[model samples]
Structures are given as C-alpha cells and as structure tokens.
Target chain A: MTVAVDIKNRLGDFSLEARFESAGRLTALFGPSGSGKTSLVNLIGGLLRPDQGRIAAEGRVFVDTQAGVFVPKHKRRIGYVFQEPRLFPHLNVRSNLSYGRWFTPKGERHDDMGRVVELLGIGHLLDRRPSHLSGGEKQRVAIGRALLASPRLLLMDEPLAALDDARKAEIMPYIERLRDETKTPIVYVTHSIAEVARLASDVVVMAGGKVAAHGPTAEIMQRLDLLSEEEIGEGGSVVDMTVSAHDESFGMSVLHSAAGEVRVSGLGTPVGASVRVRIRARDVIIATERPRGLSALNILSGKIASISSGNGTLADVLIDCSGQIILARITRQSCHALALEPGKPVFAVVKTVSFDRANTMSGVKPG
Target chain B: MEWLDLSPEEWNAVRLSIKVATWAMVASLPPGLLIALLLARGKFWGKSIVNGIVHLPLILPPVVTGYLLLLTFGRRGPAGAFLAEHFGIVFSFRWTGAALACAIMGFPLMVRAIRLSIEAVDRRLEAAAGTLGANPIWVFLTITLPLTLPGVIAGMILSFAKAMGEFGATITFVSNIPGETQTLPSAIYTFTQVPGGDAGALRLTLVSIVISMAALIASEALSRRLGRRMDLE
Candidate 1:
C-alpha cells in the first residue's frame, strides 16, 4: 500500500506545507521538535483538515480539497497510537480491545485477536485494567488495540517518547514485528534518529516545516549532503550483517557484512544469525596504507568515492568498499597529509571495541 | 408512629412531590447533557453568552426566575402559546408547570456537574477512539458518556434533590394548588400558614431533609462505585 500526501495548512503564523509518498511498510517522519512532524501525521490521519491538498492511501481518497471531499477520521480507517496509551479507562483491557471491533463493520474485520495478543505478548494482561499495567504494557496494549481495529494505516506519534530507555527497548521489538508482519502501512513519527534507523524502512526528513528529503533508509542515512551539516557530523550508515563464525581462541565473533567479514568483540549470537550494526563516520579512520602494529581489528581496503566539505574545519569522506558504503569524517589537515582523493586506495580502520554494542541487534535474519 | 400517620392531604403532597421531581429530572437530563457537552467541548461564537444564558436561573433569585418563566411560558407567551396550539399542551396552572419551574431552577446545577466532568475527560482519548473507527456519536455514547457517568449521576441526583425542595419558583409559576401544583415544600409552606398546622409543617420539613440526605448519600455511593470500576482510585 502507498500513502501520498501533499497538504498545506496554516495554524496562526506557522505554516505547514509538505509533500511526500511512501510505499515502505514503515515510513518515519523524522525531525526535531517544532518541525511539524506531528502536524503532518495528523493531516494524514484526518485529525487535522488542511487548507488545500490531496491525500490518498491504498488508492482510496481520504482528503481531496479540490473536490471538496473530506472523509472523517473514523471512516479513514487509520489507527492512531499516541504517546499516552489513551485506553478507555472505564473499560477493562478486554473491552478496550473489543471497542474497535464494535465499530468495525462485520465483513471488514480481518485481524485475528489471538495472534495479535500473542504478537504483542499481552495475553496474560487481557483481563487487567489499564491502571494496573506498567507504562510499557499499556503501550503494547494500545498497539494491539489499534491493530485489532483492522485499519488501513497506523500512525504512531512518538510512542516511545514517554517511556524510559528500558521501556523503549522493550517495545521496539514488538513494533518491529508489527512492521514486518502487518500489511497495513504505518507512519511512525519521532525525533530520535536511532529509532528511525532501527524501525523505518523509509525515512522522510523534515526541517522548518518542509520535506527536506525522502528515500530508502540506508540511502538517506548515507547522504551527507542532503542531511543537515550538524546531523552529518554525527550521523552514519547502518549495515545488516550476520555472525559467520565465532572464534573462542580470539575472543571475537566474525560478522559478515556486504563489504567483507568484520571481526567484532561479541559472542551472543550463533552462526548465521543476522545482526544490524551502526558505524558512525566520526568513529572511522582512514590510512593511506596498511599500518602494522595497530590495535584496531578492522581494516578494509577501499577507494574514496567522494569528499564533502562541512561547515567547520572537517570533511566527510565517502569510501566505497566493494558494493557497501562507509563514511569517515576527518580534518582537512588529515586529508591534505594523507592525500585522500576519489579513486585513492586506502584502508578504512575501525577499532573492534569501538563498535557500539548498544545500538547493535542480533538474531534477526536478513530478509 | 404519629409522624407516620399522614393525612390524605399530606399523602397527596408527598406523591405529587415525587411525580414532579421525577418528571423534572427526566425532562431536563437530555437538554442538560447537551448543554454541558456544548459548553464543555464546543468552540463557537458567543459561547460565553450561551454559557451565561444557561446559568442565569442559578444566579437569579428563585422568585424572579419563576416570574420570568411565568411570563415566557404563560398561556399567551410565544413558546407556551405555540405548544398549546400545536400539541394541546398546557404548562401554566398545572402539575407539568410545577415540573417546568423545578427543572429550570435545577438546570444549572445539573449542567455544571456534567460540564466539569466532561471537561475533565481527556480529549485525546476521544480522538483515539475516533481513529479506531468510531464515529462522533458512537464515541460519545461508548466513551465520553460512560467515562463521565459519575458526573451524570451526580448531576441527576443534585437536580432531583433541588427539584424536590423547589419552593419559590414552583409557587410563583404554577401556584400552590393542593393536589395539582403543590409539592412538598409548597405544601409545608401552606401548612405553616395556619395556627394549628405547625405539627404537619414540622413533619414535612423532616421528610424533606431525609429525602435530600438520602439522595446525597446515594450519589456519593454510586460515584464511588463507578470510580472504583473505572480504576480512578
């Protein structure tokens, strides 16, 4: 299913004009606070009426101002999960789940309750009241409630913003499962780049109430020129790899990336289990030749593809190793001393321990 | 035992009071809830003016409110004449007129209770329900109304008790006709006017106090039960 939205709305002095389309299973609206990400989602969900625009989801017209046709939020068949759970306090968990079903016309109900409950791991909490559940459990139930509504699309507005880091990690897997298993298109909104990296199949970058860029997750993450200079300084690429082998003698596990095999200091995964690793540009170092006696465990030979000038005294070097792309940020002085240029053969060095294990995920096989 | 021995007149007054208060609550609940929702949730021009109009009876002297009702709902008044001509309905000098005055006097309290509760309800929850495929009316009935039930019950009891004790308005608008327009308060007023009727008046006063206290206790218990069920505790 595809969601196409081009809407312009004015709320006092703040004007929102955005146009973007996504066929990805989960498209993230990523921006900073006051960047109008939530406003854009509200327009798509039919919660806010736009002054002029057209919105279509799965080939169905939700809002077309030129035609003077505006479908109400309920008929749009879009489920919304807010930062707060917003569960009906008067109803028990079971009744809250069934509330959406009550409004679903008999012939349109498609989602299975048992599977949803199992998927969200809320089976035991079915009879409990919302007040009795923890923050994470409430969000999970909220997700399940939205899913049971059999919506055409789901909108999650900073679902993890209110939770602690542990709670966020707790709910991330359930959201990933939802993204992978459900056919419904989801528009997830967040200001956290890490959340977008881990959850979004496509990323729509927003700035100053405008769509700055939109593309597949990996490509957008790698585009230093399109991203804000500040983000490029801190942002990097994510690679999905798998544990190829574990060496007990070396105290490391061999991970196979698209570029080449990478040996990292981790041993939790069995062989052939997929893992996602994020490599920030600032963490990478480039050497003109293979340096001996280096403590860094990763050294891949690659040709420099491009060099980008940043706002400060730094430059971002894009290295193309085989088919995979890696970014390195270095001072202009380093570039001058190393003579780094396009097509120059260099070794991208990454310290084994430098890989952030917190952002790493294992046991997910590549699709 | 002596208090239990009510003469036929006292029995008619008690029954009439029940009938008037019940009818008044039933008749006013729908409008009260509608006004409460509008005032609590709606954004419109002249909203404050509308709010004030709904609350005028509460602030005005009960006798003045009754006088205004009599002028507007009398046989020749615009609304009263139209209803009388179209539906053969009459309010002045009748039991229904007593109910009308009591409802008017009790309306602001009912609306205030319901409005406060409605305002207290989270609008985001209603928006979430809307996104879950519930139309506006369905959301109100299934979510809004049920969530605000404690307030609705409180409003009903408050209005019922107010109607039960309504004196100035009922007497001024519908007059104290013995079995027709005379409610408990009006009957007590009539009994106190005579030299030998002090005992009867004291008895009715005690009954009125008992009924008001009972209504208050019932409302409190009901609200508490609902709060527990909703996990508001």
Candidate 2:
C-alpha cells in the first residue's frame, strides 16, 4: 500500500508544507514536539482540510482541493487513534468497539468483532465501562475499536505518548502485532526516536513544519544530524535479527543477523521469532586490536567505512560488517590515538545489549 | 385526616396543575433540546440574538411575558388566527392556553440546563466518534445525547417545576375559570381574595410544596443514576 500526500496547511503562524509517499507498511512521522507531525497525520485522516495540494492512498483520492474533492472523515475509511484514548464514557467496551461498524455499509464491513477483541486481548474487558479501564487497557480498546472499522489506512498520533513507560511497554507488542498481522497501512506520529527505531519500517523526518528527510528506517536512522539536540543521544543503527537459539544455562538469547551473532541477557522471546534491535552509537567502543580479557561479549571485526564528527568531542564511525552497517560513536582523541580511517581494520566492542523495551521489538522479519 | 381533607374544587385545581405542567414539559422537550443544541454547538451568525430571545421570558416580568404571549397567541393575533383557521387549534382563555403560557415561561430554564450540559461534553469524544465512521448525526445521537442525559433530566425537571409554580403568565394569558383554566396557583390566588378561604388555600399550598419537592428529589435521583451508569461519578 502507498500513502501519497502533498499538502500545505496554514494554522496561525505555522505553515506546514509536507510532501512524501511511503510504501512501507508502517511509516513513522518522526519529529520533536511542535514539528507538525500530528498535523500531517490529521490531514491524511481527513480531520483537517488542506488549503492546497492533493492526498491519495492506494490510488483513491481522499482530498484534492483544486478538484473540489473532499471526502468527509466518516466516508474516508481511515481510522485515527489520538494521543488520548478518547473512548465514549457512556458506552461499554463492547459498544465502543462496535461503534464504527454501525456506520460502515453491511457489504463493505470486513472485521469480525470476536477477532478484533481477541487481537487486542480485550475480550475480558468487553463489559467494562471506559472509565473503569486503566491507561493501557483503554488504549487497547481504542485500537480494537479502530480496527473493527476495517479502515483502509490508520493514523496514530502519539498513541503511546500519554502513557507511562510501563504502560507504553505493555502496548508496544500489540502495536507490533498490528503492524505485522493487519492489512491496513499505518502512518504513525511520534516525537520519540526510540519508538521510530522499534516500530517503523520507514521514517519521515519533520522539522519546522516541513519534511526534512524521508527514507527507509535504517538509512534515516544513521543520519544523527537529522535528530534534535535532545534526541541526538537516542539516535542509532537499527538491525533486523532473528532469534537463533536459547542459551538456557545463562538465561540469555542469541540473535542472528547480517552483522553476526549477538547474545542478549534476559530475553524471553521464543526461538525463531524475528526481533529488531537498536544499538545506540554511544554504547559502542572501538578497539584497535582484538582484546582477549574484555568483559563485553559482543564483538564484530570490520573495516571502517566512514566517520563524521559532531560539534562535541565525539565522532561517529560507520562499520560495514558483512555488508550491514553498524555505527559507533567515539571521541576524536581516540580516533587520533588509534589512527582510525577508511578501510582500516578494527574491532567494534558493544558495551551492552539494549534489551530495554524501548529498543527491542518482536515479530517483523526482513523480507 | 380532617386538616388533610381537600374539597372537590381544590382537588380539581391540583389535578389541573399536574396536567398543565405535564403537558408543558412534554410539549417543550423536543424544541428545548433542539434549541439547546443550537446554542451550544451551532456557529451561525446572530447566535447571541437567538440566545437573547430564548432568555427573554426569564428576564422580562412575568406579566410582560404573559402580555406578549396573549398578543401573539390570542384569537385575533396573526399567529393565533392562522393556527385557528388552518389547524383549528386555539389557545385563548382555555386550559391549553394555560399550558402554552407555562411552557413559554419555563422554556428558558430548561434550555439553559440542557445547554450547559451540552457545552460540558468532551468534544474530543465526538471527534473520535467521527473517526470511527459515525456521521455527525449519529455521533450526536449515540455519544452526545447519551452523555448529556443527566442534563436533559435536570432541564425537564426545571421546566416541570417552573410550570407548576407559574402564576402571573398563566392568569394573564388565560383568565382563571373554575373547572377549566384554574390551576393550583390560580385557585390559591382566588382563595386569598375571599373570606373563609384560608383553610382551602393552606391545603393547596401544602400540596404544591409536596409536588415541587418530589420533582426536585426525582431529578436528583435520576441524574445520579445516569451519572453512575456513565461511570462519570
């Protein structure tokens, strides 16, 4: 599925001029706060009318101002999950989940209520009122409600922003399941680099109400310059890996990828499952020679591809390991001390495996 | 038992007051909800003017409101003449005329209560409903209306109580007539004008208090029940 958007909207002093087409199943609109990410998703969902330009998804025109074509939100067949749950307080979980089905024509409805309820693991909550639910449960119900509508495209505007970290962790796996299992294309909006690394197949970088960059997740993730000052620390390389085996003796799991095998402690996922891992550049240490007494377990030998220095004492080195690129950030003094340059052989020592919920995602294997 | 005794005329007055108030509340409900929705959500020009006219009966003297009603709804008045000729409906010096007067006098209270509740509704929920594929009308009916039911009940009770206590407007628009347009308040007023009528007026006065108190309690219980159902409490 392809989502095509070229729209210009002026809200007060902030004028958004964004144009991009993403064919990834899950495309992330990634930016910091006040960057018009939410506004871009709103334009796609038909909640806001654009002053100019056209928007089409899967070859169906949703809005074309010059052509006088504007499908209302209800007829747009697009689902939206807002920052807040926004569930109807007066309706129970069952009714809220089925609300959109009442408006969809009988012949066009494709989602089954039972399947949606099970998909979100909200079957037990069908009778409870929205007010009685916790933050995570409410978001799950909201997702189920939108899915039951069988929208052609889904727009998520910071679905996890309102939740605490524990709640966000609880909802992330379900979202990953949705991205992998559902047929609907999703345009997710978030100000979090960690979320984009874990959840998005493609990323659209927004800055000052414009599309600063757009590319595949791996390519866009390496461009640390595209991140803001605060998010620069979180920028890293994303690698798709599969769980190869379980080291039950040490209670660890081994992940196999093009970059080679890496063992992570405290992983609970079953073997043969696909997982995406993000290795932050700040967490890597480069060794001129392969050290023998090092406590760190992950080490990959590769020739240095390139290096870019940031404004601080740190410089990012790109390592092309078996055709898979891994980024490492080190100080310029170390670079000079080691005489590191392009085509120089070196060892990249991974300090720690980020098994944190924010950096790891399951169930999306590279095709 | 002896002091509680109500003569036939007093009973007729009590019964007539109940009937008139019920009719007033019922007949004005649809229009009250409509106008409340308009005032709360519609973005048309002259909104403030429409709001001022709806509230005219509240601020104007009851006697003035009654006079205006008589001028418009009397047999010789243009609206009255058109209705009487086209639909054979008349509101001149009759019990139905008393109901019309009470409804007009109570309209502002009902609309105000409903409008406040409508305004309190979280518009985000409505927008969410729209994204869920509910059209505007469906969103209002399923989400907006259910959420505002407590206010609707409060408005209905306010209208009923106002209609029950109405005196100046009803008496001026439809002159008091025994066994016809004479409401409880009108009967009480008539008793105050005559000698040896204190006992009868005292009896009707107690009944009026009981009805009004009952309405207040019922409204409270109903809104609380609705609140609990919505998990809003």
Candidate 3:
C-alpha cells in the first residue's frame, strides 16, 4: 500500500472515523466542506494526531497507537500544500523554495531545485516575494517549495480552492504533471468532483465524518446514490478514451474506448494521448432504439443494466455498452413509457455540445 | 556657548545614563523575547497569572516596584545575600543595580509589543514549515523571528527609551551616587534642587528630548525598512 490510514479522532462535538488503503499515485479525499476531509488529510500528514489508529505511508509507520509510536510531521517527510499557499512573507521566493532543502538530510535529498522549478514553471518568480506573486503563481511556487523538500508522501488540501476558475485552470495542468512525472505518492483533498475526476486515480468518498465509499475513480463515480444531493446530477461514468483520430476540418477529435467513438471539441494533445471524459448522467439521454438523424452526435447501443428511482419523480438508468457502463437520468414517466428494465437493449445518446472543456480532461500521454 | 556647554559632572551623568540604558536594553532582549513567545503561544495553568505578573511593574507605582527590587536584591536580603556570597555580585548603590531596575521597569512595555507581534504571525506558515521538515526551533528561527523583526525593534527602542528616562525606580533602588548611579534624570533632579543650577538642568532637559526623539525616529525608520523587506507595508 502506498498509503494506509485507520484512525478515529474527535474535535469538540465533531468526530471522525476513517479507514482506507490506496496504492494509487494520486488518491483523492473527496467530500463536502464539513465532511472532515481536511482533518483526515491533516491526520495523514502528521499535523493532527489520532486518538486511536495506525497510519503508514510507503511501508513506514507514521502513527501506531497500539505500539505507542507517533512520528512528528517534520520527521515523517510529508509535503503539504495548504489551501492558502502559506508562503513565508519575509523570505523571497528563492529562499522560501530552498527553506525545506536545508532541513532535509543531505543523503536523503532527491529533489533538484532546477528540475522542480522547471516542472512548476516558476523560474521567473525566484527573486519575487510571496506578496508580489499572483494567486496562481503563488500556488505554483508553493508546490515547488514542497517538492524541494523531497517528501515521501505529498498531501494537498484543496490546493486550488482559493483560486478563481481561470487560476484553477492554470494550476491544474501542473498538478497533473506532478502526478504523472513524480515518484512520490500524493493524497489530494477536494470537494469538487470535477477535480477528483480529472486528477485522482483512486478516491475515498467521505460524508458526515465517515467514509461513505472508497474505490477506483471510475467505479466510485458511477454510483450516483453515494453522491450528495448537489453532486448527484454531476455524477456519472468516467471513461478513459484514447485519441484515435482528429477531424481537423470539423474541429473535432475522435476518442476511441471499449464502448465506442466519442467526438468532442478539438483537443490540444496529439493523437494517441489518453484523455479522461466525464459523461454526466444528467446530460445523457436514453432511447429505446437507435435514434435516426438526431441533433445529438454521439450514440452507443447498450443493454439496460439497472434502473433505480428515488421519490417517484426521476429514475437513473445504468447501461452497459459492450463492457463499458454508462449512466443516464430521466423522468419516471419516460422510464415507464419506454418500458426500460434490466437486460433490455437500448441506446445512450449524448449531445456533442454537452461535453465541454470542463467535462474533458486531456494531457495524459499514452505510455 | 559658555552657558550651553555641560560641565564635567553633567557629562558624567549623560555618559552613565547612556551606558545604563544601552546595557538594560541589550540585556533584556533574549529574556524579553522568550517571555513574549511564552505569553503569546503557551497554554499553561497559570498563564493568566504569568501575564498579570509580567504587567505588574506597568500597573504598580514606580516607587513600590523599586522598593520591591531593593528588598529582593539588597545585600541583607536572602536572594541578595546568596548572590553576593556565591557570585561576588553586589546591587546596593551600584550602576548595575540601576540597570537592573530600569530593565524591570521597561520589561512590560517590551514584552507587550513583542507579544502582540508574535500573536499576529500567521501560524499556518509555521505549520507549513513543519510539514516541510523544519523542526519547531528551526521554524521559530527562520519564520517566526524574522517575521517579527519590526516588532522586536520597536520593543527594543521602547525599552531603551524607558531606561533612558528612568528616575523614580532607579533612584529608589540605587541611590544617586554622582559618578556611579546618577543617571541623566537624577542629575537633572539634583540641578533643580540647587539655587544656581538652572542652566545645567535646562541643557540636560534639551539633551533628553533630543535622545528620545532620535530613538523614536530610529525605530520608525527601522520598522519601515523591515516592513518593506517583508512586503508587509
């Protein structure tokens, strides 16, 4: 296991009990604001001690209550990127970035300042103070500072939460690069499902101070019942589709998966790159038969795997196209009119415009 | 020019006052910082009582504080006797005793300024440092202390100015011995008591104003420079 945590802690009237193990390169702690996700990250980072539990990363035990062992955060070698990019105001960017390097044991150090600066694109900001940098630039410098420490486990607590949409867009690609290129394991915290779908390979869904579900990103995302009410509309199937061809004339790209070809807006990456696409259940429309000449461009024939209805107003239909699963939410009247049921042949149609840049995460170069 | 020029006796008091104030300011810094940090960040059973005791000199009459210092540090006193016997130190009517009294009198102001600054420091930055492998002491040295530079300078100046003008406490704790413990304030008091000493008192009063104004201006410039360096301004 890359990271393992079984902990119980209490703060005032709120208590948290979490247990999960993940070996994924980027594991997301997904939850709403008050769901104790940050507290869990703090526990893993050794910032908060658990009243009872054991936490280990990379086969080294950080805290084991039974054994009476609790390592301090400084010795645990965990890098944390907080929500506010807490940079030392008195130090220049160069000094702040190198601050951790001085404390890391020389023999154990692996992070090269040159490589980290290049990775985060913060070379021009070395001489600037923290107050001089913009929000996006500060966050990038913060990431570089943490990476320079050469931590064994990197913990990010909503690193982009304080940024606007434009800034979030700017910083996300660097985080993806860090996930893909770095050797260290990362545990990211976020309440945004879009962020989880874009970056996380594994997810631990938290609710009401407990682990509601924990599994691979794709599997956990499709379980709409596990999502909060606000997130239910956004929850759906996440599919990794390889870029097989790009229709330059039409300004569209064809993504091939096991299910079928999906055409979205023109992508920036070259052909053969793997991109993750989120098909929101609310955006999907289920049909009894293959519709002819509809405005919706993408349609995949599948069999209805399951139908679940809550409160008798709407229903969620799960369709299996070849071996890939797709989710569609429709009204109960339409569900009953079409006589949808398990093992029934159907087609799941989605409009090309429904898949915007926010729904598509590209930049994973195929290995 | 003849009347403005200070006599040798007046010069001695001015020199002695500067030495005592400088010594008092320098000697109290380390303890002042430690105590400020403790009061700002520590959580203990008698924290309020510690805070109260630290502020006692500020609230209590200067004479009472000076008398208390005399009673504790005097040669016949228990602490005074032990220190005198063991360490060959003396506090009665000595310049060092005046410095000790000034340091005590100025301590509350120093600690208050430093404590407020320490409390204003963003603890999140410290926690971030901890996660990056900086131990607690390293965090204080690199993050906490550097960020609190302006306040530290302010506290030092406050303590220095308080020591420079210190009269009641110094006089009571250590008597006005002209070449030993007669600081500027004591010297001025002496000039004011005599019949033909008006010119000496006026000259020394002008000197005191200049010194106080210089200390304040120096502190303002220093803190502003630090603020600019930290981008806090």
Candidate with top DockQ is 1
List, residue by residue over B49-130, the lDDT tens digit for candidate 3.
9999999999999999889988999988788889899999998899999999999999999999999999999898999999
> Across residues A1-367, which tens digit of lDDT does each residue of candidate 2 receive?
4799999999999999999999998999999889999889989888899999999997799999999999889888888999999998888999989988988888878889987776788889999999999999999999989888889888999999999998988888788878878888889999888788888999999999999999999989899889988878777788888889999899878899988899888466767877788888888899989989988899988889999986779899999888889899889999989999999988888887554373335453211
Clashes of each: 0, 0, 0
Candidate 2's displacement at residue A352, Å, is 2.0
A best-first ranking of the candidates according to their DockQ comes to 1, 3, 2
Error of 1 at A139 (Å): 0.8
DockQ of candidate 3, scored on C-alphas against the true complex (2 decimals): 0.74
TM-score of each: 0.94, 0.96, 0.96
> Residue A190 error for model 1, in Å?
1.2
Candidate 2 interface RMSD, angstroms, 1 decimal: 1.5
True contacts kept of each: 0.88, 0.80, 0.86
Q: Rate the local accuracy (lDDT) of all candidates.
A: 0.87, 0.89, 0.90
DockQ of each: 0.75, 0.69, 0.74
What is the DockQ score of candidate 2, to 2 decimals? 0.69
* Candidate 3 displacement at residue B137 in angstroms: 0.8
Model 1 C-alpha lDDT per residue in residues B1-233, reported as the tens digit of each score: 77657889998998999999999999999999999999999999999999999899888999998888888888988889989999999999999999999998899999999999999988889999999999999999998999999999999998999999999988999899999999999999998898989889988888888888988898899999999989851
